[model samples]
Target: METDSPTIPKRTLADLLFILFLRLVAVSCFWFGLQYWAMLVGYSLVGAGRFDLLSLPWKVASTSLAVLFPVASLGLWLTVSWGPVIWVLAAGGQVLMYGLLPDIFGPNKLIILLHLMVAAVYCIFRLLLWLEKRRHRRQVSVDLP
Candidate 1:
């Protein structure tokens, strides 16, 4: 029985790698979220970083991130479409906080750099996957009568 819908493509090595990367990122997001919570709850080693003592901007930034990162982690761990969107929002928030508003958030060059690198790698992997899919489709069409 022929159907109009195209056959679902089997998962490839690239797909596996992408999923692995997503899971790794999810773990990192979880860790980052935990750290924010620790600071907010006075569990962190630095007493000065506690939420009650934090400045207004820091309070806002920390609270938002404390919520966002773990939610992002859950979505990412599931490997759903919204996962990356949430991750981007969470990461971009930090980028803006530390990269642009350094005076308020302080300079976290390492984190900003890490986010940029992860973004670049994600783009590259997506491009490669797209190209591989396109090539597979072309080959499949050529093989048909």
Candidate 2:
């Protein structure tokens, strides 16, 4: 006679992908925050003239980003559903700031790229969460005895 023990479901590809994406976003946010902090401190000490291209306006922008990104990233990592929305807003704001106020903030090709990348990851993660929830509902419906 053979006895069967319950087995846990293995992690799906989607789960792995979502986890990897989350890690990537977390790391990106950490690095971006560090850069902003450094810029804020450096600008305060050396004056905007030392980095004329990235003047006072750019310093202000960096300080704002440093304050916000870490909060958004932490919220997301803690599995708060609002995290994605915050990230989206931050990214959108940055894009608009870069496009509409280039003169004051200066042009930054890298920032545009970073915003696009973060947006893509946020969308993907949200989709994955939706699918997982749907799957869970279906399982409950079917398992009802």
Candidate 3:
């Protein structure tokens, strides 16, 4: 006999891939957060990376990222709605740091490129999922007639 609980819908391959991607990004976020914390706490391999020695700009960017990345990591790992939102904020922070103020925060072309690529992939997956859902709805409506 079936229980009163509603059945959970199965995740499609696209959904699985999206989740995998998010988890991978979450791992990277965790690493970045760790690095920031290390720098702030004077555990960085390079002495120059330490927070106390850093100038105002570096301190601001590092502290903000140190806080944001891990929170984004948690959200991303869970694959909740807030995950992507936080990720966007964190990534956008990096973009602004490197892209808009390269002199203050050294230019990081690689980071920018990777963020763009990941964002593009996420958008593509979302579009594909929306299309699949729309097609399924049409099919279901036709079958009902």
| lDDT score, candidate 1, position 143 | 94
TM-score of 1: 0.91
lDDT (CA) for every model shown?
0.92, 0.68, 0.88
Cα error, residue 59 of model 1, in Å, equals 1.2
Candidate 1, which segments miss by more than 4 Å at Cα?
1-8
Give me the runs in candidate 2 sitting further than 4 Å from their true place: 1-12, 43-56
Q: Give the per-residue lDDT of model 1 (tens digit) for 5-30.
A: 46755788999999999999999999
> How do all the candidates rank in terms of TM-score, highest first?
1, 3, 2
Which model scores highest in lDDT?
Answer: 1
Compose the digit string of candidate 2's lDDT tens values, residues 12-83: 677777767766676676676676676666654454433344656765666677877786677667656666
RMSD of 2: 5.0
Worst 10 residues of 3 by lDDT: 1-10
Error of 2 at 13 (Å): 3.7
Better of 2 and 3 by lDDT: 3
Residues 38-93 of candidate 3 have per-residue lDDT tens digits of 98888886776888898998898899999999999999999898988888888998
Clash pairs of candidate 2?
Answer: none
